[model samples]
Target: MKLAYFYRNLNQGGIQKMIVNAANYFVEQGNDVSVVLMIPGGEYVSLLDPRIKLIYFRSLKKSRLFFSFSDILKREKFDVLFTATPSLNTFTVIGRLMARVKTKIVISERNNTVVFFKNSALTLSKLTFLSIPLLYRFADAIVAVSKGLGQSLQKVALIPANKIHVIYNPAWSPELEKQAGLPVQHEWLNDDTVPVLITVGRLVDAKNHALLIDAIALLSKKREVRLIIIGEGPLREKLQSQINSLNLQDCISLEGFKLNPVSWMSKANLFVLSSDYEGFGNVLVEALAAGLTIVSTDCDYGPAEILEDRYGFLVPIGQVNALSEQINYALDHPIDRDLLISRAREFSVNQIMQHYQSLFSTLIS
Candidate 1:
């Protein structure tokens, strides 16, 4: 099958990572894979599989993407097209028609559509996202990364239940072990005596890192556990201010972005998330794979799905006390390392690839 993935760019986000990972997986399986990006440059361009073709319709602004992308689709004539996010998904529907191609278009809702549109920062975003119900019907299939997200998509996108299916992202790969084995620079990460807690993601309002800071501050009163926050964003100065004001300078260290975060996860005793919303908790799965005990807010779309059964514990979103208590419990009562790794394998690349392959096969057959 000649498969193409349409995305905004090669940016360093969970969706982009999945697109690149899936494209590579398809290529490895002897299918021709092409990554179609609206923009040309991103940090993750280097991470993509060399066997996969990268088609970047560069210098094309929003107003012009439809025309430019349709031209490429007509020429490339991929057997199937996978698009994530509303903007690209909507465009894929238009592009396919404009190109008059026979490609099976699979629209993937990467985030909890309801919560996303509800919390959209701009009026235009909210209005644009509301159009999903109308545009998505043209696609060959609709995918939600989690069952929770699938339900949300059905409700928010106003799509019928039969139109949606759940497919967990390929969060774990065989290569992850090699990446986890990569040497980390931080001394405290591997130090068992430190009792470290780790969280990864951009410092953003949606991530609600401030809540995590507050929870850690609550824990610091009675214990000496440390925190390693990976990734950078605009919230650095604000988060730093909160840490300084709380006199938590010694307990929390914003390590910024580490290319190989699994190395840090490899040593951390616990993984935490205080996000108010999540598309899918990719890092939670990564933490499980790294054998870290997990505690996160029972936030919409992802945390509860990730924490189902005994894999981890989920506290209600924005509840500092509950989050703090769960963190403390995970610290004291450790989950079995083998069990965490085993559960993580449920979302391994091979498993997710099969689900995607099933979709492609169905379309071709």
Candidate 2:
């Protein structure tokens, strides 16, 4: 199979990682795999497997215009086209109309469509969402990262229930294991007296970083807990101000985007995700893989589904007090470290690749 994977960029995100993993797996399995990045380029370009060819469609912006992608589709003959994100849904739909390649197009939704469009700029984002019944008409299949997200596509986007399939994001187990033996770079994290709490994601409103900060402030009053948030975004200044106001300068630290977060995850005593909503908490899986006792907000789609009673504790979303309590409880009665590692195996790269193999066979057969 000659598979063409389409994505906005090769950024350090779950969806991008999934696409890279799937494409690389397919290529290693003797299939012709190529990645077509909509955005020109970025740091994650190096992360793509050297074996898989890469192309950049510089003209493919996050807009309603379809000429650029349609032109590419007309020239490249692919057996299957796996397009990620809703922004490219319209492009794939239009490609089917204008392109010579009769590619079997499979569209995947990485985020909640309703939440994504709530503040989108493109007039067509709203229209494309409203016209999902028609936009998806050209798609061979629609893949959702979680069952909850699949149901949302059906309920909110009006996509047919029969057309949406749930496939959770593959875990970062391989990377975690690889980095486990690596030396810890941060001097502050070399100590064992203080419990380190790590959160990995963009510092955004939806991520609810403020809540995590509040919870950390609450935790600081009693215990020796150090919070390290990885990733940079618009919320940095606001979050820094909150940290200063709460006098959490010593307890909480914002270490903006590290190329490798696995080292931090491996060193951390605990991992927590406080997102208000998530399609699939990829970082939570990474944390679990790194064998950290976990605590997460019971977000709409992922945390409750991933972190069951055995693996970690889930508190109600936006409840900083409850989040703080759970963190304290986990710290006091730490879960069996080996058991957490054992549970993380369920999301290993080989296991997830096999799932993708099965889905690809089923979709293209």
C-alpha RMSD values across all candidates: 1.4, 2.1
Question: Model 2, 218-294: lDDT tens per residue?
Answer: 88888879999998889999999999999989888899987678778889888899988888887887777777889
Residue-wise C-alpha lDDT for candidate 1, range 20-48, written one tens digit per residue = 78988899999999998878877778888
lDDT of each: 0.86, 0.81
Off by over 4 Å in 2: 58-65, 119-124
**Model 1: CA > 4 A from native:** none
Best by TM-score: 1
Which residue pairs of candidate 2 clash? none
Give the C-alpha lDDT of model 2: 0.81
lDDT of 1: 0.86
